[model samples]
Target chain A: MTLEEVRHLLDAEVLSGHEYMKKEVSKAFSCDLMSDALTSVEDRTLLLTGLVNPHTVRTAEMLDISGVVFVRGKVPDEDTIKLAKENGIVIMITKYTLYVSSGILYSNGLEGASILHN
Target chain B: MITIKLKYQVEKDDFMKAGQASSNLKKVLKQLGINSKIVRKIAIATYEAEMNIIIHSEGGSIDASIDPEKVKIIVRDRGPGIKDIELAMKAGYSTASQKVRELGFGAGMGLPNIKRCCDEFAIRSSFGEYTELSITIYHSGNNTEEGGE
Candidate 1:
């Protein structure tokens, strides 16, 4: 699915990389743990996380994650937003919890980042 | 036949800047035109090592040597070294405090994840002295499966 579709589905507000809204994402990994995200996902997957911090951005950067969806109505601090912008990562905020956000996307045919990679 | 070296000093408990070293390394590698897959592996390994120093050690440094064939990262930290290296290498064994967990880390997967990303991995530690990790990722001709995800 395209990031634009995800934005509409979750009612998410883009906080960074607005120009990349049409970016395509085939898989997503939802977790608060940076370690878990690092361990599991591959490059270009979307990260749905409630953990709002610079580390989240850094993790995305390391994994080449295409974008981050900040779930649970959480907003990242200035540093977090700055880092995401610097890396050209799309950052969005959603009012839904991580569970609901994952459900919405999954129900819409977005696959989870495969556990076989771990 | 040139090697680029980058060094970073990491402060203990400095959660604010824990991943800075790895981030900078990633940028340098990209600017140097390293393969994105190899750069990603190196960055992840180095970042995990950096976080281990900040979250567990007194302080440390990470040094990267990048060349045409491979990148090697050396992480050295002065801290209460691991008494059980084998146990520490386990997938879910972590000694991080609750505070660290609340921040979305200390899940005990750091070392294992680092190993997973490296073409060459070695770790050494003395219980009271320090711990050192040597991680190397080849630039090409690697056995790591690509496009598997």
Candidate 2:
């Protein structure tokens, strides 16, 4: 689904990068840990998490993630949102928990990249 | 035909600025007309490693360079050298503190991720001295039949 569809489905508010709503996204990965996403996330994936930090945007930049969804109503500070805007990563704030968020996206056809094991 | 030297001082315990070094490198690569996909791979791999150094070491430094042929990133830290390189290289081994883990790092895959992305990778460390990692990825090898590209 595209960013617009995800926003509508989750009833989320676009906290930043509304321009990126037209972008297409295929897979979704939910993790509170930045390292796992760093190791495993792949092309055009959507990252669902509760952590609020600039590293989140950095993570999307490195992995080329489609966008970032802040689950459980977590809202990042100004710096974090500003960085996301600069990096051009689509960002949204949703009230759903990580599990619920992941399920909604998954049921809607988003996928995780192949499990990369050591 | 040119070489650029860049340095980043990863401030200790500054989780907010974790990937600045790698991001700057990515910016430079993009301006140089490096392929977007390849730059993404390099950015992720190097940034992960850079974060590890800052959170694990006592504020380390990264020295990076680039040229027409490829991009190179060298991350050096004076933290206690990995007590066990083999275990550390494991996907699940991490020495990062609880706080670091809370930021989503210390999964023990930093070294492996760096190795996976670059065409040439090297790591050297001394117990009391420091740990230095050298990574080189030829632009051509980036997209070859090598999986991602």
Candidate 3:
């Protein structure tokens, strides 16, 4: 789905990269562990994470992730948001917990970015 | 042959700057028109190595060299080194502190992940002294093979 659709479906606030909402993301990976995310996430996937830190954005940049959704009403600090913007990654804030957000996205046809190993 | 060499210093416990070297290397690779897949692999491997220095070591330097045939990243640090290389090579073994783990890393996957992403990987260290990693990924035009010794 397009990021625009994701934003609307989750009732999220656009925290950065507002101009790139038209970008389409096929898979979503929800995890707070940056190591697991690094091991699993594919290019252009959406990262749904509760970890609000610069490292989160750094992980997205390293993996070429399309965007990040901050679950559980979590919002990144200024440095984190700035880093996301610099990396051209779209960021959104949502009130839903990680699990609920994943469920909503899954029901809407957004699939998980499956890991080959844990 | 003209090769590009870049050096970056990673500070101890500077989580915010952990991935800068890798990110910069990724940008350079992309600008050089390296294959996206190859670029991604290099980025992942380099980032993992960089994170290791930030989380586990006192400090380190990453030296990256890019040529037409391949890219090589060497990360060296002076710190308390791995005592058991074999066990540390396992997929889920980490000695990162609680603060590092809270950042979503230190899950014992960093080294394994780096090894998986490179065409060649080698590590050497003396306990309580230092650790060093050498990772290389070859560019084979279109069909790139993945493996390392």
CAPRI-style class, candidate 1: medium
Candidate 2 on B1-149: residue-level lDDT in tens? 47878888887677767788888888887776677667877887789778877877777888878776887888888767776677777777777788777777777778888888777888888776678888988884433322231
Off by over 4 Å in 2: B141-149
Using DockQ as the yardstick, the better of models 1 and 2 is 1
lDDT of 3 by residue, A44-63 (tens): 68999999999999888888
> What would the per-residue lDDT of candidate 1 be over residues A1-118, giving only the tens digit for each residue?
9999999999999999998898889989999998888886465699999999898999898898878999999999999999889889999999999999999999999999874243
Compose the digit string of candidate 3's lDDT tens values, residues B1-149: 36999999999988756788999999988778777777888998889989899888999999999887899899999899999999999988888889889988998988888888888999999999999999999985733323210
Clashes of each: 0, 2, 0
Best by DockQ: 1
Better of 1 and 2 by lDDT: 1
**Fnat for every candidate:** 0.62, 0.66, 0.74
Q: Residue B58 in model 3: shift from native, Å?
A: 1.4
Which regions of candidate 1 are displaced past 4 Å?
A115-118, B141-149
Model 3 DockQ class? medium
What's the TM-score of every candidate structure? 0.94, 0.91, 0.95
lDDT of each: 0.88, 0.80, 0.88
